[model samples]
Target chain A: MDAEKKNYGKLFFSTFKLSACTFGGGFVIIPLMRKKFVEELHWIEEQEMLDLTAIAQSSPGAIAVNASILVGYHVAGVPGALVTVAGTVLPPLIIISIISFFYTAFRDNAIVNMAMTGMLAGVAAVICDVVITMAGGVLRQKRVLPVLVMLLSFAAVRFFNVNIILIILICGAIGAADTYLRARKGAGAK
Target chain B: MIYLELLWSFIQIGLFSIGGGYAAMPLIQRQVVDLHPWLTMTQFADIMAIAEMTPGPIAINSATFVGIQVGGLPGALVATIGCVLPSCVIVMTLAYVYYRFRGLTMVQGVLAGLRPAVIAMIASAGISLIILSFFGQRELPADLSGVQPIPVLIFCAALVILRKWKVNPIYVMAGAGLISIVVYSAF
Candidate 1:
């Protein structure tokens, strides 16, 4: 029993570490999640893992958190989910808190300011990289309609100051409509 | 009152926030700058800039920054908890039920559709950040001429190199911080 408990602890932390290191969020973390939880730890099987990602995205939360909970629960039930959420959330909370306390002082400091300015531009570049990667994915699927919706929503909010909730709802509505049409077509064929 | 406000703001952020840190940016801007007026656009942008350099989700850092801006330490605590609460509750519930229906066609189709949209949403957020990084609310910079391009170049080069070499982002962030301290001091 002790040994079993130890393995669960190990799984919990490993999932946490993988979650911690992931950048660009969610999908980017999928590979890491798979490597640690599926390939390395054998905590979940392949299909179940895909199931978790789907649910995580569709649900109203951070993908990483949802994924972690599902995987942790799969491995060790409720206790596992709690542990995983803690491990995932704790580090970021602590680190960000420390940062907030010092942020103002850091902002006025010239050298630090310059470095941060430069770094922010770098963030811009990184974002561009993600955009390119995502464009490729959407282009591959010939999902031009949704891609246009994303761009328009982004443009509307950023440039025109449209409400974000409205944008998401609009796109989500389009998605629903698309799904309905496809289902209806399938039904007719059958 | 402050703590409650902070909690409510975060609860809203947590519940509506899907995708990731960037997804929450516009809404956070609305709350911090427009609704609460706790932080200016410049300050919030600065916080996001720093958050990007740091090693965590952008939303958490934004919460901490806004929290401190509003009501100091306690405010920060309330906000962080609020931001995390929805995800914690919903995900745990989903986990309990997720096992029952592991794979179904409608589920698969819905996900297949959401995938492109998720990518779209994230990509758009990235683009928005890029614009914000370059230009603020009041006026757009005429050009990138005055900007110190070297550091920016080095950072981009480092990201691609690190990713290709599979070096951890923590190390990259640390290395970037070191370079800034050294060069900025020298200059």
Candidate 2:
């Protein structure tokens, strides 16, 4: 009980710091998180942290918020996830409140406009990085099905205009079958 | 009445926001700009820039910003709760499922299939941004006359540096902004 309470406190403050320092949200939370929780705190193992981050991104809502839920849940269960979510959301909420009051200044300033416009490219780059990093991981698994699914998913959205929901559903079916077949094969081999 | 609208719209946003991140952007655009007129296209763009510049999830920031614009602190609270509630419920459900059926091959297989598909979703989001920044369109066009050289250059350089050096994206973003200032000023 005491341990969980301690973890809750640590999770809150740690996520608070990570989310506060994190800019642009999404998968951006992962590296800062890995540094703090896995490397420093030893709270989660490296592979486990990777899995959590991947799942956090893969699911829904905001990746940063989703990640907090996952890392918090992994570390301390539902309550822990709640605590981390609070930590993650509070800083931005406070900042957004302040900025909204003066949004006119932000909206009108020429320099701000230029900066944001310029940052557009950088934002694209950051996203491309996410794609490469994630796709590279899938490729490295040396598994044909994952690689095939990954490419098909990309084409379906990028070119074919297929609904994302459909893609996800189809992929889920494929993935399940892949896992089932693989397991059966392994069993027979043994 | 507005609070209810805020709550309902954001709940929909949260419910459908499967891959998170930029995955939610189009949905937010649809809700705030197209469906509700809660914010104009320009205003939505501004909020997006602000969201990128700030910390926290884009969805939460938008919910708070939109709520504040439409109502006030109460609106902000309502919209934020709307945004977060689905994430809580969904993540809880999936996490529970995984934990409860950790050994279930069917469950693992479903997740495994979902994994790559999820990555593709993010990739799709990024590609849209790439098209927007480079070609000045949400979707790439045939003419390509609308191409913006500055962002294209920055995108190329930034992508290279990111891949090669593994630099923190914060600096890369700031640097792009700075480049914009100088480049635009000179022109």
Cα lDDT of model 1 by residue, B5-81, tens digit: 88988888777666665666656767777788688766766676666655456676777778887888778778877
What's the CA RMSD for each of the models? 4.0, 3.9
Q: How accurate is candidate 1 locally (lDDT)?
A: 0.67
User: Model 2 Cα displacement at B49 (Å)?
Assistant: 3.9
User: How far out, in Å, is residue A102 in model 2?
Assistant: 2.7
Q: Write the per-residue lDDT of candidate 1 for residues A39-116, one digit (tens) a residue.
A: 987868898788787777766556676777777777777787778776766666677778777877888998777666
Cα lDDT computed for each candidate against the true fold: 0.67, 0.81
Going through the candidates in order, their DockQ values are: 0.40, 0.59
Off by over 4 Å in 2: A1-14, A24-59, A70-81, A142-144, B1-5, B12-48, B69-71, B93-108, B135-142
Error of 1 at A54 (Å): 2.8
Docking class of 1: acceptable
